[model samples]
Target chain A: MQENRSIPVMDVLIAVLLIAAGVASAMSARHLGKSVLEPIGPGAFPLAGSFLLIALSLLVIWRAVRVGTTKSNVDEFKPRPGMAVLALALTCAYFLVMQLEWLSFRWATVGYVTLLTAALFDWQPRKLPAAIVSGLIMGLGLTYAFTQVLYVDLPS
Target chain B: MEFLLPAIANVFTPMPFLMMLLGTTIGIVVGAIPGLSGGMVIALTLPLTFFMESTHALILMVSMYVGSTSGGLISATLMRMPGTPAALMTILDGFPMAKRGQPGRALGFGIMASFAGGMVSWLFLALLSPPLAEIAVRFGPYEIFSMTLVALMLISAVSAGSMIKGLLSGFLGILVSMVGVDPSSGALRLTFGVPDLETGFRLLPVILGMLVMSQVIGDIVNINQPIERVQTSFRSMFMSMNDLRRQWTNILRSSLIGTWIGILPGIGGTTAAIASYTTARNFSKTPEKFGTGTEDGIVAAETANNAAVNGALVPLITLGIPGSVIDVLLLGALIIHNLTPGPLLFQDSPEVAYGIIAGALVANVFMFIFMILGTPIIARLMYVSRAYLIPPIIVFCVIGAFAQGNRLFDVWIMLAFGVLGFLMMKAKIPTGPFVIGYILAPIAETQLRSGLMVYDSSFLPLLTRPVSAAFLVIAVLTLFWPFLMKRRKAPTAPAHLEDE
Candidate 1:
């Protein structure tokens, strides 16, 4: 577990950032204390959390130097483009739909259900009707199950 | 021994028994699907229990808890796709066997081992939980603070890259939890002047936001990706007696390791499974044969992960500290049922308390049947195209987030957190630490500040308080051990993860 693998220099940079954040946290803790709680007061756990992080980061770098290239999957980081954006957009829309109450619980369910299933199954525009129909059906079914049989009312 | 009979009878009641069977069968199917998770099942069902009597609802829930958790191995072993993150390690060695056309053996051993680990842990929970709760009754703010510190120390075990990032995420989580008006004083630390800020953030929304949404975002990034496929035969889903005889010791050892890890504060089942898998592989006679479809690897990982499910429940039941996010959801559900678990639960509601234990045992019995019977059926889900899987889940994620407390703003938070989660994940920050930190921050603050008050704002009292000092020492020791051990045996600390 302990090898002197040379750490990527960025680790040390991250450590420095951690130390700075810890100091800032400590200072903020003092400032907020007059109204909230004092330095190491409301901020005690977080301050400690930040400090421990700094130390742990330092240790990882130190160990990385000794135990170089410890794992093959270290660079397994990957990113997707439109999918993330689409998911985010859908989530944001879901939020707005809830806020306006323009869509009742049942409608909201159908909208989300249909959109999600199409998104999930990678459906095309031509298939939109089918997705919407199924979503509406499942939505109504769940709404009925919860509101009528289960007797749990959905929020407006 | 004599008291155990009554416990069995309590679980075997006609309705309770039927629910257990039904829950486990449903749990396995859901769990074996690649995109769905144990938490999702609990989330969807959480509302269903609100209308029911508590014990019956709990019976259904616990059966699902046991069954779904165990069923992760089916996909992990046969399809090379982990049903959940915990099963990821199972696939490392498991898929090789499936590729070699011995998937039945892998799946079989995983199922049987899951049953055994889950059953043994249930027994442990049944026997040990009451006594543990009794001990917790003696805990004061000093003791609780110490416990939180120990939990903080566990972050070292959970964090992946640099301990710094792990600890930072933990600290960040604590800071986030401090958003609402101060519980002790009416001052807001982080929240701006929104009325919703008064209650701070709801746990379910925040969790669903970060865990589920982040995942959806990650999926979206690769919506058009084509993944390789694995070929499988439903053949040989049974382990031979000799294979069984060879693995008894490995099974027991891994179950013990998983439970012990579960008993720890923040490590959860991911570490438990990895640890169990690593240990089983390291000690096996055919170590070289590992990662090439060895039966024991699947067994060890499957058993440990499932056992860890019950193991994680220990802290939730005894100390009121959730051992994982699922436990956090369970805690929320308990509140809905008017069943707040803690040291006093055993005294106030022995029937409810014992009922959960009895129910878990029942859950696992159902887990065994459902796992064995449903494996062939569930193995077919791997055939579902990813194109057909992603969109619907995103919709559910949106609805799930909205359903938590029904604030649309909360859904925004979920979307934001989802992207943030995906980013953090991309940046290699461990998500588990953020969650554990979030849950513990409030507790740690209340305990530490209260302890300070009890000692009249004096730092001297903190050092002198026997419990606090002991806990601090343990935390420090746990943190520095990796460093110390690294220094002494830098060449061979074994591996940090995946037990085998």
Candidate 2:
């Protein structure tokens, strides 16, 4: 499936990151000692894997560039901008708020789910109430199930 | 065999039985929904199983697996959509049959065929897994390491999208697994001085984030899209004697196909179903009627996919290699309970092995019963709003991640991987390799290192030993096959580079 090519700029970026990661892994492995007697150190596998990764990442970049230079890229998927941003923001904020102890885990989840659902549905007037109710059920039901039945402690 | 009685007794006991019932019910509901999958459900529910006995957990997961395969028929027949990927072919004939006013009859055929498939495949699973484990027991570290490499290469080659992306994902998974203290040297290799990083990422949260949370986020992004609902009533919910008599051969054939495919590593039920459906059509004297609301098509599709469910368990139980993404979670569940899989599992925890095999049989029976009785209720759930469903799953994802180490760091790791998974999906990269890579990397590394130690760091043994050499040769071929195929197809379409 790699013959027809659209230049994926994002993929190029990922390849660069992968290259950087490989370098970083190699640097990290250098700190761990490896000798002839102990050929397999803690860092041995990581070093080998990272070098393999670096080589592969270069191959990916070469292929991506080759495809982009040859012809126009395929029609790419365009996710709804508003929906994408809102979902991402809410997810990050949910993690941050819970981590910072701004609110109890249960409350933060309830608020996040309720708002996220409404936003995702674009606040259709007739569907708004049901969406809110659904969020509430999900939030509370999960809290109870996890804490009571599963015995998982939610951050308080 | 000595453990068989205890295994049966353990599974039939009250708590495990109840969990199976609950798991089956939940599986049906999740499977009936278009976006949700049995894998995601198991991943999300894994933490809850963390405290349970390994046998009970196996029973629960196995029942859910069976129920989900059966549950797909509800949506496949009612709507044109397959509830699960395995049901994709079912829509060809199932939906058409439902539209032709024989909804109940079509549903009956699917249900009955699924049962027959499950029974036939369960026979293979029960009989084959032990002997396979026995054979696997003889494998040395070199053989094991080479075999693991072969599994990784094969999975990367067969994944849905670009082979390179799949390989990259798998290697990336290996990198991720190497983040903490090295198991061999007792030295911190990649923790970056963070105490949490000392242990690296736990498998549960990593899996939950990628499979469940990523899916939830993706679903939420497209939440505005509406489903096409079908209104239908049940009638004649039983396969006639003549229909059963005529389709017996098809059922048996499809089941055997599924079982054999399931034994092969990395491939899943969808392939089995498609293969069975195609074979059945070719063999049918009335080929013209195959896809035109024919019972033969539904039977072939449903039977094979369900049979594959049990077939997939063979390698998982014996070799510790997951055949599909869902089975990876099953492996994760086993690890969570401190029950290591592989040939030693059969020798050490014979009861767990026997219990799982027995539980699958019981679960299949329960799945058939539940699908018949719970059809009406499950049909309603198919229309449940993504807004409602997606949010709860996210909540569960968080709880699942947090429950793993009772740490916030793991939760963040989950969110990070979720985003990574989402982007990978968007890029047309298959997440299958990533999970398999993540799960198998440690195994491969450990085994390779041990093998090297055994051979005094001579790589020659890997290529000189017959079994190991064969595996290494296959791995090389598996990795190159995609590129070879792509090269052959290159002249046809220069635009197909994105097919990865």
Local distance difference test, each candidate: 0.69, 0.81
RMSD of 1: 5.0
lDDT of 2 by residue, B374-457 (tens): 788888889877766766677778888888788988888898898888877766667778888888888888888788788888
* DockQ value of candidate 1: 0.30
Give the per-residue lDDT digits (tens) of candidate 1, residues B1-500.
34445756877888777777777776787677776777667755765666777777777777777777877787777666677777877887777877777777777888888888888787778778888988887777777877776765666666765566666666666666777766665556554457876677766566665666666566666555444446766677677889889889988998998887777665677778877876776787887676777778788888898888888788777767666666766766776688755666677766666777788887887777766776777777655655445555554554555555666666667666666666666656666677767766676677767766666666675567686688778778867755664576445324433243
The DockQ scores of all candidates, in the order shown, are 0.30, 0.46
- CAPRI category for model 2: acceptable
TM-scores vs. true structure, each candidate: 0.83, 0.91
**Model 1 vs. true fold: TM:** 0.83
The lowest-lDDT stretch of 10 consecutive residues in candidate 2 chain B is B491-500
